[model samples]
Target: MNESKHNTQFLGLLGQSSTFISAFSVAQVCLTWYVFSFTGSAVAVGLVAILETLAALLVSLPVGTLVDRLNKGMLLAVSGVAGFAVFLILSFNVLFFSFDMAAVLMLAVVWGASREITRSAGLSALPDVVTSGTIAKSNGIYRALRSSLESISNALAGGLIVALGVLSGFLFSAGAYLASALFAAFILLPFLKSKTATHPSGQEKKPSMLEDLKEGFRWLVARKGFFLLTVSATFFNFFMDMIITYYVIYVAVGINATSLVYGLILSALAAGDVSGSLIGGRLNLLKYSGKINVVLFGGIPGLCILAMGIVPGIYTAILFTFIVGLCFGISVNVWLTTAHNIVPPNMRGRYFAIDGALSSISPVAIAAGAAVIALYGIMVDFIISGILMVLFTFVFASMRSLWKLDGRVHKERPANEAT
Candidate 1:
């Protein structure tokens, strides 16, 4: 009965999360499209995306701390409701009031903050919503399915905006949030929903926010293996995002591919990723140990990068991009699975917040990458980047810290000690 209840709650949580991400993706596209259509400025479009993200990152620490201090399930619902309110206000501002860029930007910030709340709360709540045995699968399905949904949502966004109008677009996103809130409120469990943050054992006073944040930092640093994994994760996110940021220029200018061909290439990448995520979710990727699995998947992407740069035709480029996506996608899901299982429930929100903060600075890498492309050419950039990635990634298979994360080393230790 307990398993059945957890499964039921997981389904509801999935519904709530899917709608949240799908709506945000589509709404962002619509919002950016409207700004571009009216202003005819690429900078304005970029601003919309950047500001929203910036707002979220600015609030990440506080949001994560708040998530830890509250009932995570209820917080998720609150996030949904808050998102709904933001979209509705934006809709009214655009539809009735005069359209002001400042107003739009302000609301975007609000939406981003609300979205971050959901993110932190959801990550913290996920472990409790499903059995430990399904943690890997749940994490994979949650992310991969959301990615697939976002892709589809963005694909149809332009058509929807054209046919339905931008006001309708805002309302549509608002409706998604409303639906999400309903699912969260009615179907999601309130398990661990209260402020249960523990201080030092036998202490009466709760920690201050700074103390809580400091403790989260302490928690990560105290575990050397996990700290290494966190650094590895940050490096992967930085490098991978840099690749994505520059990939378009390579296709559009370097190869001079048509928009249709480019679209197909992206589709292929997405397909490979979704498929690989499903595969990773189902298998015990640690069978060869996490170290070997990480090295294999991580290094394969480097080879794919080399192939993508060296391959002559658009078709060949697409194939290698697909391979890169597949390998990287698997590595990502495996790490999420492993991390989800390892993080203490009380620390998940703060841990992920710190992780996210590390990722937020990744845009700096694009500047370095851009300099390389400008001076060395995109092909040279790819070659150098791929070689470095391979040299470093082909580097992880023997990291005993990873082996111990899953107890492979611990099991051997017991046997050796017994002998």
Candidate 2:
């Protein structure tokens, strides 16, 4: 009975999460593909990404503050509506005009900002719905499900584009986003309707937005483990950003892959991520904390990256990349769950924002990495990045004092205690 109830609640949350993610993933993939096809320049794609990241960086702190101070459900709902509006404007702009790249970039930037806000608010609201004891597994399941849905959605978008055309694909994506907004609006149906079991108290007299943001900053800085972890993880994030921005281009140029192949590779990565997320959730990470499991587990990806570079054939590389994806899925879910465990609930949004700001701005790194790859070679970048990520995992895991949150006062109270 307990398991059945857990499944029911989780599935309900998944319904809302999957819908938003499906729309976001599909629209983003279609828009990016449309731009790349039109321009035929990886640099152009990188520039648009840079603009979007810039928007996210600027808006992240303010959005985090809002998520901390305001009603999280309303904040999420407003962001969804804003995202729908942004997509509608983009669709109209492309439909009527000759498709100006500058204008399109602006729209994408706006969309990125909305996406950042929505994500921060939604994540901050999650603890209110689920207990900390289950947070790790819950996060793993959420990551896995979201990745799988995104994979399917991107594949569908590719098929739609091929059958109809880029214009129709954009329109379809826009409609899906609008539908997502409508779903998000239902979040206002009241506590009786949604009925979350976990709710942190003292939110009614929450601090001002600025104070909230400051509190988060202080929490991170005052904690030794968190500060070190954040600094170390930045390098890993930088490399991952470079990979996300350039992997499509790598396949297109190096492997001479078509749109279908691109979509397939993406799907493979997402598949790996899905598997990883599911497994990570079920794993006994606590049993092996500060052990070699952290680094050795992540070694799965490092080895996969090496295999991909040396594999020779596109099919073989795809298989290797899928394995790499699974490792990435595990690495991200585990790290996030671990961080959430260590950080206070009120500070999660701020720490997530800082993570977002660091990870989100990789377009500049993307551009630089691309240049370096072109000048030197893609294999070199892959090897160097994979090694660095593995190294960081080890270094971070060894920070024993920081890992325990010695400075911060979580009070170790029961979950039933009021905030």
The CA lDDT of each predicted structure is 0.69, 0.66
| Model 2 agreement with the true structure over 1-419: per-residue lDDT tens digits | 32422754355446656777877777767777878888877677778777887888889988876665556555556666666776777778777888689887888788878788777866665555566667777888788889998788877777777777666666666666655555455543243134322235855664666776776676666655446555655666676666566666667776777666767777888888899888877786543332323453445566666565555357876797788778777766666676667666656677788767655657667777667576766666666666766776666676675344332124544333322
Number of the top-ranking candidate, with lDDT as the measure: 1
Q: Clashing pairs in model 2?
A: 225-402
Worst lDDT run of 10 residues, candidate 1, spans 410-419
| Shift of residue 236 alpha carbon in model 1, Å | 2.1
lDDT of 2 at 368: 70
Q: Indicate which candidate wins on TM-score.
A: 2
Q: Write the per-residue lDDT of candidate 1 for residues 153-194, one digit (tens) a residue.
A: 655565576577778778888999888888878877454544
